[model samples]
Structure formats: structure tokens, C-alpha cells
Target: MEIGFEELPVMNLAFVIDKSGSMNAADKMGWVKDAFGIFIDRVRDIDFVSLVVFDSSAR
Candidate 1:
């Protein structure tokens, strides 16, 4: 199933994450990435999404 982004209204999204070494444990990063991927899939192309991943600092 797919939602057409062209007809969707414009919106803003923000995704914050931790990229520290501890996040690499127990497949945490994998799970987070997977979840984010699925979530981003739901966003429309006309919308804006921001991904902010930080470990020791915000980049």
C-alpha cells in the first residue's frame, strides 16, 4: 500500500537520534533505522522531514 504524496498537504517532521557507541549495542541502531525507514515511508514527498542524529555532538 502507498499513499500519493502529490495530493498530500505539506508538513514538517523532525527525527532525532543518538549515534553514540552505546547505541550500537543489541542491534539498537538497526531497530531505530528500521523504524525510521518505515515511518519515512509514510511521509509525503511534498512534506519536509528533518533527521538529526547526534552522538558526542549534534551534526
Candidate 2:
């Protein structure tokens, strides 16, 4: 039996990021950015991506 990759559904991903003062400690925020860059590069063109960042306020 053979599987059809084209028949699979597209992926939707949402990432919530923390931007508070604590995130600046020990370069935690830098790590998050680097990880996110790696992830976004691996996603297919058909995939959807959304990001939400929060600190004292969110936008």
C-alpha cells in the first residue's frame, strides 16, 4: 500500500511569546528568536503561521 502525501491537510501554527523584562535575562529572548527562525524556515509554503507577543500589554 502507498500513502498519498498530497491528500494530507495543511498545517496551522500559532506561537505565543513572552516579552516581559524577565525574558531579557540570560539571553532567553534571543534563544526564542533563534528557535522561531529555525521553525519558520522548516514549515511548508501551504502552512499558516501566527504569532502573539505579550509583556505588560499584547498586540
Candidate 3:
């Protein structure tokens, strides 16, 4: 039995980050950065990634 596809589908990923004043507490921001780095490394070559950071408002 074979469980594979001839072509792989593209993936779209979005990451939302918090830039509020509290994020700096206990190296929280560092953890977030590390998580994002790992995610980028694991994504497929044909994948699309987007980032949205919000503190008071989103841009």
C-alpha cells in the first residue's frame, strides 16, 4: 500500500506576535523569536509565510 501524492500542496502560514510591554517579561519575546525561527526552518520550499505584529493595533 502506498500513502503518498505525486505532487505536494503549497502551505500558507501566518504568525501573530504580541509587541505589548509585557512581552519583555521573563524573556518571552526571545521564546517567541525562537519558535518562529523553528517554524520557518520546518516549512516547505513552496510555502508562503506572513507575519502580523500587534501591540495596540495590527498593521
TM-score of every model versus the real structure: 0.78, 0.84, 0.80
By TM-score, the best candidate is 2
Which pairs clash in the backbone of model 1?
none
Q: Name the top lDDT candidate.
A: 2
Give candidate 1 misplaced runs (Cα > 4 Å). Answer: 1-9
Model 3 misplaced regions, further than 4 Å: 1-8
Model 1 has an lDDT value of: 0.88
TM-score pick, better of 1 and 3: 3
- Tell me the deviation in Å of residue 19 in model 2: 0.4
State each model's C-alpha RMSD to the native: 4.1, 2.5, 2.7
User: Which of candidates 2 and 3 reaches a greater lDDT?
Assistant: 2
RMSD of 1: 4.1
lDDT, each prediction: 0.88, 0.91, 0.86
Task: Using lDDT as the measure, name the better of candidate 1 and candidate 2.
Answer: 2
lDDT of 3 by residue, 1-59 (tens): 75444355787878889989999899999999998999888787888999999999997
Candidate 3 versus the native: TM-score?
A: 0.80
